[model samples]
Target: MYVFGDSLVDNGNNNFLRSIAKSNYYPYGIDSNRGTATGKFSNGDTFVDYLGAWLGLPAPPPFADPTTTGPRILGGVNYASAAAGILDETGQHYGERYSLSQQVINFETTLSQLRTMMSGPNLSRYLSKAIAVVVLGSNDYINNYLLPGLYPTSFNYNPTQFANLLLNHYARQLVALYSVGLRKFVLAGLGPLGCIPNQRATGQGPPGRCVDYVNQILGPFNQGLLSLVDALNNGSHPGSIFVYGNSYAAMGDILNNPARYGFRVVDRGCCGFGQQITCLPWMPPCFDRTQYVFWDAFHPTQAVDAVLAHRAYAGPPSDCHPINVQQLALINFL
Candidate 1:
């Protein structure tokens, strides 16, 4: 399987980049990787790591690794980067980051290498069976469109129009990926962006509550994504399997039922900073991560991520549409 998108699936890719959106520091990854951070936004494992383990596969290595050669490529790669988004300008404030367009290009290189390493039939079988996970768009909303001064995308389009624009562009990118022979795709929806600690810190709404207006924008986009999935599976792409991971609903469940989900904190992040800040070099992480829903101002803690991924991978119909990832993987598309 291959993982793509932003900090939610980053797994240390940004450590190699000259970007500020990195987690290779203390108090991050203290639970996983033996107390040394590995560049995931979470304090422990990420969505991809949990999903990979559930699928009986090792977590894919970062694509940026110099040693990602030969059979290592067979397990696939993680092209996700901290602060990356579908739109190039989404994370412009963070300097260099892999836009979705760039991630596709990297996958193209991987396809090229696979062709070199295997027979044609084997390559086709490999692509048709492998799963590609995409978790993006939150940064496109939180970091760009709503940044107020850094970008003008929000000004040019209303929420409905913006959702259409993103869906249209995203469709083209997904088709470009399909062109290279990928069959199974996991399209993750954006979570409730307004409720995350960083967005709360933005002061766009009343303190200690979710910013409903910002979160409202995510629904139209997620609906469009679901429609896209249905279209892809309804004979548009023969043998294609696409499943929607409802991250929004998952996050809602966590926030509304934290203690039920075994989490103690739902509103604030585990890492320390001022009311609006998070995980600064001066700030240290809380001692107990299992209690917190978020690890930083923007990302979920690993403990929370595991629950989300488990549900998306094998939860009921509400967590993953059409069929969950477990069912999606079991089918023989060929």
Candidate 2:
């Protein structure tokens, strides 16, 4: 399995980049087993790490990291970069970052090198069997379309128009990966962005209540994304298997009914205070990471990531439409 997207899945790719969207610092991975930060945005593992382990594969190395060079690429290389979005200029505020277009281009280069390193038949088998997993659209909506002054997308187009634009571009990105020989895909929906500590604090929607407007704004994108996945699965590629992961619903379930998922604090973050500025190098985190849904302002705790990953792997119909990740991986697609 290969992974791509923003800080949610970025293991360490942004660490090498000149981008300010880096998480390779103290307290970020305060509980990632070894207790040392590894560029993961959360207090422990990212959702991808848990998903990879559940699939019986060690988490793939970041595509750009020095340690990922040579033969290690075969296990699959993660091209995810923190602050990445569907469009090239989406995260310009961060200075330097990989857009979805660039990540695909990087994947193409990796595939080209793989073809050289392996026999043609072996490479073919590898490419055809691999699952191209992507988690996107959130940064596009939050960083590009919502930042009215910094980005023209939101000002130029309203919510619906902006969603259509994002979906159209997203379709092209998926097709690009299809052309590169990936047959199975896991397209994750953006989670409850407005409910996150960062959004809640910035939007200021009364104490303990989520920012309804922000969450409402993202509804169109999720709905459109579901439809887009269905269209793509309908022979956009002859043997393609595309699974839509309902991230909004998955995270919402936990937020709405925290105890049901073994969580206690769904509103606040476990690390630092539940504010956008919390969880820096100087701040100390809460004692129990398992109780809170969020690790910091933007990312989920390892506990929440584990829950979300398990659901995506073998979840009910509401969380993963058509099928789940494990089911998608089992498909022959030939």
Top model number, lDDT: 1
Query: Which 10-residue span in candidate 1 carries the lowest summed lDDT?
Result: 273-282
Candidate 1 on 8-92: residue-level lDDT in tens? Answer: 8998788888898888887777788677777777678998899998999998989887888789989989999888889877898
Q: Model 1: runs farther than 4 Å from truth?
A: none
Q: Which stretches of candidate 2 lie over 4 Å from their true place?
A: none
Candidate 1 vs. true structure, TM-score: 0.97
- Report lDDT (Cα) of residue 309, candidate 2: 92
Of candidate 2, the 10-residue stretch with the lowest lDDT total is 270-279
lDDT of 2 at 326: 86
Candidate 2 local distance difference test against the native: 0.85
Candidates' lDDT values, in order? 0.86, 0.85
Candidate 2: lDDT of 227? Answer: 95
lDDT of each residue in 195-309, candidate 2, tens digit only: 9888888755877888888888788888999999889878757878888999999899889999987889877777667767447774678888888998888888888889889
